[model samples]
Target: MRIARMHLNESPFKPSRLVSSHVSKYVDKLNLYHVEELEAEFLKKLSSYTKLPRESISLYPGSSEALIALVRFCRSRALKLVSIWPSFHGFVEFANMEGVGVDFVYLTPESFELDLAKLTAVGSRSKALYLANPNNPTSNILFQDKDTLDFLSSRFGLVIVDEAYFEFSGYTAADGVLDYDNLVVVRTFSKAFSLAGARVGYVLTNQELSEEIGRYTALFSVSTTSLASALGALEDIDYMMEIVKKVIELREELKRDVEKLGLYALNSKTNFLFIKTPTLGRVLARSLSEKGIKIRAYNDRLIENYIRVSVSSREDNLRFTEALAALLRERSTVG
Candidate 1:
């Protein structure tokens, strides 16, 4: 049986050869903590890759860790949070752990796009506004320019933009950090670089904010091998880009195929496609799972009958599309 794992939204590809090669060099250092010098060198490499100043970057074991740390930092200040409904749930989950609540602004019912006006209203009163570019679950983007820039420039508290899908979407607010003191952009090497297991991610903000968040990161949160793997992934940028390009191509094709099934797929800029499945969501998911294919299915009130599918290799996607078409056809026949 063939399995298609699309629920986690990770690339089906392996990390670059450089990652394996460099990680092997650190095999003997497994017992040692990630040294300060090694951490500094990794920061420099990340700085070069992201075109941000060295002082602005802070590392974590993963973006999830960085998000939890930031949430804790904000919660300490007695700040309320604002975020979109059905967005990435990591920060929200952490905020709850910190005894903080989120004021959620739901996206438009049809397009799944952010309501900038409503967001501005809620965000202005909150302590921090959190967003995921090429947002999770929906896989749609909030405009990076006009409205988003205006929000970042406002006194609407600290704005946290999770750009974990930046390499896939090609739109980012990282450069906005130079202009907005309250803006914090987070990224990871997990998706495009195929380094999910390495668990290396970074935060980009000004010196003051970076220092503030850095306090929450435990000493040596990122392992020596993880740092080395991240550095190696950075060095192999072209290889990652090639994979990203292929994923984008496959993503578009998958979207088209999904739409042909009479379901609504958001115009996604990320590596995944979110289809509004409505009434048959559970049935469709069960059918696909029985076929050895897996994808995320939502049963929540706000996003009921929804599925998020990660764009995989051509062969995997073809198999999924075929399986999906079969399911829909079966439904039609039974009806």
Candidate 2:
């Protein structure tokens, strides 16, 4: 049995003409500067979108590196980290490598929202909390309310919100950073900005803490190409929003389509949608792969028989339908 991995939806669109023509041409042609100035400019532009003070920003190679740096900082202090489950798998790994204690609060599959009561016991002992606002894999969204945010801020020493999918959701706790000294919001260009290869990400916190993170982070963590691309990406804010708008529309359409297939979609505000299929997940994945379509499949004990498919354009969606439909029919014939 051969298996293959596929990316559902990538940056659907190519890099803008402005990025190719204006900002990057000079550097790619001949002149190149260190990423410091580029990072500074990009962060300055990012400040306009986020409410946090610009000086509170730390640029990184990407969200993955930034996360590792965070783990290092918490490890140095030997603080316990508590995170909700059904998150990016790296949370568990980060805790283990740093030798920091970890606590998990698994949300029920039905609501897929945090259990506030269950978390009350956690923050007091929690030195740092990691969360994905519109969580990955399961794609459950939370904190459209105040009580949970207030409870977290009051008790936890640090509450980190990974809003990598915020561009699609139009929601954030980055503004909460203004009110709560303990809040840190992490964002990336990979998702919405279509700059995944650019390896650009930034953290929003107070200036003092930002400096501390910078001290621990790689000095030239950002690449000159990434810095220029990010600046160019930010330059066309309307185009970014247009891409987000299309993805949101496609995500809803995908949810409806999945439901029609006797599968349920976890409410998603990301570029990807999680679909539940009782026993056909692996089968469907294999079938799709043989047909040249790719997506992520998940079969954990808690979340058995499901796959995450990125919300692509109409053509790809139709191709998925064609492949999956054939697979289902073949299974019926075999049975």
Best by lDDT: 1
Candidate 1, lDDT over the whole model: 0.84
Give the per-residue lDDT digits (tens) of candidate 2, residues 1-335. 32222353355666655676545454753344474556667778888878556787788988877877887776766666878877777767766776666778887666678877777766673478888988877776777666677888887888888888988888888777767878878888888888887788888888776777667676666767777788888898888988888878877887787777767788888888878766657667766877878887755666657777887766777677666766777777888
Tens digit per residue, CA lDDT, model 1, 196-256: 9999989999989999998987988888999889888888999999999988989999888
**After TM-score superposition, what is the CA distance of residue 124 in candidate 1 from its true location, in Å?**
2.7
For model 1, give the 10-residue run with minimal summed lDDT: 146-155
Q: In terms of TM-score, how similar is model 1 to the real structure?
A: 0.95
Cα RMSD for predicted model 1 = 1.6
Q: Work out the TM-score per prediction.
A: 0.95, 0.91
Report every candidate's CA lDDT: 0.84, 0.75
Flag regions of model 1 displaced more than 4 Å: none
True lDDT of residue 31, candidate 1: 82
